[model samples]
Target: MDTITTLIERNDDFVENRFPSGLKLVPTLKTLIIGCVDPRVDAAHILGVQLGDAAIIRNVGGRVTPAAIEELVMLRKVTQAGGGDMGAGWDLIVLHHTQCGITRLGAEPALLATYFGVDQQELAGKAINDPHEAVTVDVAALKASSSLAGGFLVSGMVYDVETGRTEVVVAPSLLREETTVG
Candidate 1:
């Protein structure tokens, strides 16, 4: 049959034979991964993340845009609604990959500006053309978000499409850490 039909058949088999039952609304690992929308860089497949392991958010460039931050806020509210807190020791990961379509959009300044909701002049600060740099930029953005609260571990990773390997661009740390400069 067609691709959709085949997928539907697979789903039927999944629901009937192999679906895990009684998974909680909260992820088992209490982790959320923000990654590029590229199918080849799917965190679930590449990272061997099984069902309910971690929640995944995919978008262009996997940048920490305002919309993505809002999603995190909403997710926290959602977990609260489900009688679970999304704060404290939860893990947040930003994933970017090589050969992303967003790289191509960098050549189109107007489009890139529109996508980032920033002026074309400010696009250089976004590091749109580099996955490693974008990951660093995105993770820092998350760490700096006041709306996200604190006590969450956040990291950045870059996936290499050619070698199917991932490198940690930023080591995990508290999303909001208190620093006292002496």
Candidate 2:
């Protein structure tokens, strides 16, 4: 009858209809894509990327953590030994969508810190008090710690769901702007 009820009913039907393919996912995905866990944002499908091409690491707001760092290192090793490189030939896309629920945490420092398992008041004292900045900074840190080759590049961007626009926040050389004035 209401919006919430309607949404719940629709989701129930959707899952029930799709249960035949329940978690029957492919293993050994190559690329490592750090993306938000937003239902509206399907990193693989939205990017026109295929399965077995990437290992999607999703979390609240798509924030990169120590685990993400470790995953990248492991992936880098595997790719290298197999005569591949995670940084160069492969892809690493950080999909942070605009109007994200994570941004709400930004305005609430204490709650954000609590959610992230960090000292609330203490972290707020740092220059990076904003939750968005906190997440993006950590993502960048993980990218730097990766053992991917010289060609490997790391970037950050926010996807606009309404307009289907993606804006680069932290641009690695790989996704640099190539301006060709017509």
Candidate 3:
């Protein structure tokens, strides 16, 4: 069978045998995970979270660029539309991993700079070579973003591919004050 057909079969199985009916629009776990696009590192599988448990956003290197910040803004809008505010009682997890492919792109400063929406000289601050440092940077960025102004506990994590383990680099804590009411 083709990949799409096989995926359809999996969907059939999910609907018939494992679907959670009446799942709410908001994540039950009250968490949002941002992670890399690498197939080896899946936050859902690593965290053993079922569907509707958490909202996940994946992008290249999982770095918090201008685009990622905008995505968070959109998610806040989505939560508002659903009658739930993303600000309160939410955890934003910046998940990175070891031996990331993003490190390979460091030589292509132009591409990296373009992807991050920053000048080539500013690429040094991104810490693409180290997952730990990258997580720290991302957590700080999320915490300081007024676009996401409001209540959220932000944290950072690093997953080890060799051992299939995840380490919390930054523990969850309220990142900002509630600036606007829901």
- Model 1 steric clash total: 0
Cα lDDT, all candidates: 0.86, 0.61, 0.90
Residue-by-residue lDDT tens digits, candidate 2, 96-151: 77667775555788766665556876655322424345446755555454343444
Task: Tell me which of candidates 2 and 3 scores higher on lDDT.
Answer: 3
How far in Å is the alpha carbon of 130 misplaced in model 1?
0.9
Best by the TM-score measure: 3
User: What digit string (tens of lDDT, one per residue) describes model 1 on residues 1-182?
Assistant: 79999999999999999899998888989999998888898999999998988889899888899889888888887887888777676899999999998888757999888777789999998998888988998888887778886778899999999999999989998877633211
Q: How many backbone overlaps does candidate 2 show?
A: 2
Candidates' RMSD to native: 3.5, 8.8, 1.3
- For all candidates, the clash counts are 0, 2, 1
Segments of candidate 2 deviating more than 4 angstroms: 1-30, 77-85, 106-111, 114-118, 121-139, 143-151, 174-182
> How do the residues 67-136 of candidate 3 rate in per-residue lDDT, one tens digit apiece?
9989888888897899887877888899999999999997799999998888999988999999999999
lDDT of 1 at 106: 57
The lDDT-based order of candidates, best leading, equals 3, 1, 2
Ranking by TM-score: 3, 1, 2
